[model samples]
Target: MSSWFEERRADKVADAEEQRRTRAFEAELRREERRKDRDEERADKAQARRDKALRKQARAARREKTLTPGNVYRKGTLLLVAMSALAAIPAQVAYFVKKSLMLLPVPFALEGAAWVMAAGVAYADERKLPAWVRWLLRAFCLSAAGFAARINYIHGSEQGALVGWGLAAVTMLGPLYFEVRQWVITLSAAISNPRQQAEERARRKHDRRRRRHHRDVAKVADRLVSAAPYGTLKPEEAWARAWAIVHGTTEPGMTPRMHAWAVKSAAALATAQQPLPLDSKTIRTRIEGRLHASAFVLPTASGTPLGMTKSAQVVTDLPPASKTREKTPVKPARRQPPAHRRSKGDALPFHPIAKTVAADTARKVTAVNGHH
Candidate 1:
């Protein structure tokens, strides 16, 4: 009986173990399904984010393409800050003249036109056109209406209206001349700066001279200095030899015993070379100057003076022409009478303001002849 009971207990234990394994397996499968669903969700989100970013970038690019210089994009960009405070007086005069329109029928008509145009724009405010276009159109229409109203007012009143309107126009627009002058000055400064122009001119001159120098120097001497035949030599010796050949001078390896190195060293000691910077702005500015100087016009077969070709081989043979001298005639010196041996003719008496200049001259001549 004990053996049978033990067998039953083992079977029960086996059955419980089987049920636990089944539950664990189902849980694992359910967890895998949840993970798979999560991964799919993440992928979908990433795709959606990419699509959104692409759309935004496209919109920004489209906006940029619509920008134009003559439009409102450039209108308020003008800097007139320097014309402040001091210009307020004129602004006040403008305001006063604008206000005084009530005193004159012609001025009143212009003011009425302004109000009508403003009302027109106000009524159309709900229209969804671009803000810049609206502002530009309104400015144009308003200016036109004001002009027409002014003309019509003058036509109606005849001779008297003509005089009063002309006077009023001058008074009203008089301050605008200063405003125009300020605009002119601002535009001039914004367009080109004098300091920048001067610097550019200087840079162009330097580049032209430097380019020619480089072109000349690019053709090194037929033979570089060699220390093989001679003793140990410095780099200066090499430069000296090259310089002599280029300059068409016999000074190379000549007396005063200038080691090619010493001459080069002395020169290096005397002059200073500024370092070329890596910044792009500086480089661009320098390039602009060089282009402006290009008009100075170098004589070259190649479009660019720096270009090298077969003709460069015979470059030494074609030395640059030296400036010519013209023989100028020498003028002879004029002989002058001695101050001690004064002639009555040479000395004229001073006269008072009351004496007519012509009479004074005649008297002086008579006095001189009498004394002689």
Candidate 2:
């Protein structure tokens, strides 16, 4: 019986220890799951923060790009014009409503006419219509506005002095504001920058001067421009071609005849300035003549005359005439005829000095050969 009790107690202790280990394992698994959930939540929060920062940066960049001075002015002016129109309509409606139900259309028509004409002015600017058309639209807009203002003034005057002025002011302000905006848009479109305006002015002035100076060429250019297909030929190109045709030269301010005259004059001046060529024989003859002339003395008060000097008389240390003999002149070797003689058309032209230099070189070669 004692052995039986001891075995039962051992079994009970093993079961309790197993149950405790199982419970501890379950608790560890739950802690791991909670840790995983906390990590996922942190990651989500980080991603959300990054996305929000990116959106904020994008919004700022968009605003920076969109907000410009011109955009602000244009959009603000339109808003103001809209506000003016809204404010002025109530006054007109109130005045016209008391007169007659049929006359309710009159106030709308008056206000509508002014706004329509104002819009017409903007349309004219967009279509690049004539200045007079824009001015006409402006006039119509002002006329309608003026008529509306008169009606408003008359109607409000029956109420009070301050009310009359206030109604008239609001009635006129819409059209006037829109007209000024249209003017601004037109001027901005026509002249974007002061520098561009000045450049356009200068270009026009230069074109006028050129046309005045070259009337004939200008007429020909104009004719050519008129004859060509529209937008096919530029005025400058036409002018260039016409100048070439009229002057017979591609270069402006010069003609073929003028160029020929200039060349001829230059050649003549060069020839006039050039020294004459001297042959070897002429050079020797001139030297000998100078020596002979120096030997003679002119008759002075204390000296003998040149004609009375004798050949035999030893005037100084000069050698006797009998001992001196004239040097035999060496003739240059004759150049062989070329197999094919070049004609004037085939020959290349050279400077005039080249021929004189060739002759001198031949004479020198001959003289050297004779001495050798």
Candidate 3:
């Protein structure tokens, strides 16, 4: 019985040991699988890096092949692009050199060289240059002139300095003078442009109507004076009243000087014609009495006045004195602020001459009514 128990225990121990060894073998297999996966991942990464480098090199080679001068006709645009970049190299070099120089901060030496290079870029038969290059050259040339002016001001007498600076300026900017000479030609062409001439002609055509209208207005004024009866006032005063009656308002748009001109023109024409036999003083006195009786309504020109009104009538056609008279209730005049209350720059309520004229007219009117 003891031997049977011992054999069972030994069998159990061997089975347990076998299970532990199987677990260790599986763990080893899993570790080997993980290592293989890591190696594959690393190899793939290395291959991808090599492929990327190869692609970059190939692209660079293709770019270089396209830029070769022999293939210029085949890659015309590409060649131009390459040349444009090459053209820029000089300016960039100059700028760096200018920056490196501690003696001059203004960079005039590089600027002059750049200006000359600009002309080469402009007129060179090498069709590789772009339109933008012309503008870049122009900017460089403009700055070069300022440097030349500065050199002239500071060291014009130094032939050595002049030669060095001036040579750079000549190389860069000398050709720009040719472009400047075109200004006179361009201006002349603009002045003589067919389109501009046509516009000027159209403008002149419109002026004719304005001139005719002015002439017609002057004629109307002269006719008014000729029709008017003689009065106590001067010919100029009588004409002014007649003009107001004919036009209804003062001459439209006429300056004071222009109004004076129209009056003189009308008076000249009227004096040349026949005069009426009416007594001037008696006519004036009657006109004054009638004026006091009612408010006067100046007549407007009959038939198409300034093309604004279709039908009009003369002042004589106004309603009779008794019929036109109004018994309107008087409203109080606007009360003006007293002189002491007025602001510093305020105008007076009445002008001195106007006050005197009102007083004289009132006295005359009172005397006339008494006589009547």
Candidate 4:
């Protein structure tokens, strides 16, 4: 009985183990099925997206082909564009000018027109289109709508004619929004206020000349500073002086403009200070010897005109007043007429003795003339 009972227990244990194994295997199979379903779903989604994109591209291509010249698409698109613009322009103008909402169709009409124009341009061979049509197409595109919206926002922020801009925005849509804006404003200003336009042009020209002069001065300063010995003047000093001389301005200090100027000057000075070849001395010597034969001896070293070391000390030690005096021409003082000489109308304002002397000299001159 005991042995039978033990055998039953062993069989029961084996059955429990088999059942657990079966459950685990089924669970694994279910997991694999779930994973496969997920993978299939993802693949289907991706394929659907690709298919949608391909369909969209195909539709665009077909639309473009239809929009080609001599096709019905061209005529339809142009008509739609013209009708939309005609309707939208008036409505927008009225709404903006009068603040009337009765022209609610304005935005919608313009948007539709822009979309149509963009699509037509995308599809058509622009070369076959008339210049005005091409211009219209480019001026009314998807990007133009965004640009117009931006302009409206800008006008609203500036507290300017928001309504005017809002109405103008309808026609202002263009891929070349900035360029169109610039040219249109320029043209309008040229027509409306020519004096202002001329002034603006002159100002721009002056600015350009000033900038050119500044750059030229900076370059010359770089050369001057490089050739000048390091101790003679700081690069900044040289640059400042150069700027003042060139621009005829007494403004001092290293300004934002001088930052780059100084950097270039330093670079030039570095290059100038670079060591020369050993043969340079021999070459210089030979040149000097030849010059000596012509009674013109060259200095062994490049030095200042005063034969002094180039330093701030040298400049400070020298008398600038003396130098100026040497350069300035002196006029000889005019000799005063002799007190004894006198003309018929002449008399000394002061000194009675001078008056007597003049009278005596006059009598003597008369006696000489009589003798002659």
Candidate closest to the true structure, highest lDDT: 2
By lDDT: ranked, best first:
2, 4, 3, 1
- Ranking 1 against 2 by TM-score, winner: 2
For candidate 4, write residues 1-372 as lDDT tens digits: 999999999999999999999999999999999999999999999999999999999999999888775355335545544553553355444445465566556556555656666656544432355657756676666554554454344435455676546534544433233334334444454469778778999998975675475686768677888898878977667777787776666574445567679899999999999986434344546444643344312122235333223231212223344433455677885995454544554431323443554465556556545743
Q: How many residue pairs clash in each candidate?
A: 4, 0, 3, 1
Query: For this target, which candidate reaches the highest TM-score against the unseen true structure?
Result: 2
Residue 246's lDDT in candidate 3:
50
Q: Candidate 1 lDDT (Cα, whole model)?
A: 0.51
Candidates' TM-scores?
0.24, 0.56, 0.22, 0.21
The parts of candidate 2 lying over 4 Å away from their true place are 1-43, 65-67, 159-162, 189-205, 228-234, 256-372
Report the C-alpha displacement of residue 27, candidate 4, in angstroms: 0.6
Candidate 2, 1-372: lDDT as tens digits: 999999999888999999999899999999999999999999999999999999999999888766777777788888887887787777888888887777788888988999999999999999989999989989999999999888888888989988888888988888888888888878888787889899999999999999999899999999999999999999989998999989988887887888999999999999999986555666656544654555434443336443424442222322235666559885775995555543555422332443555565676657755753
Candidate 3 lDDT by residue in tens digits, 148-252: 444433342345765445444443343344334333333444577788788988877755664466555545545655676654345445445555665555654
lDDT for each residue of candidate 1 in 1-372, tens digit (9 for 90 to 100): 999999999999999999999999999999999999999999999989999999998988776654544333233322232232133223233444565755345434444444454444434444544667546646754574446434434443455876546434543342233234434544555547788888888998975674466444323532343423554554455556566666655564343345576898888877756455545455446554654444322234545443233342222214456597548875774885443544454332322321343454555556545643
Task: Identify the superior model by lDDT, candidate 1 or candidate 2.
Answer: 2
> Which scores better on lDDT, 3 or 4?
4
The alpha-carbon deviation from the true structure for residue 13 of candidate 1, after best TM-score superposition, in angstroms, is: 4.2
Candidate 4 accuracy as lDDT? 0.58
Error of 1 at 312 (Å): 74
C-alpha lDDT score of every prediction, in listed order: 0.51, 0.80, 0.54, 0.58
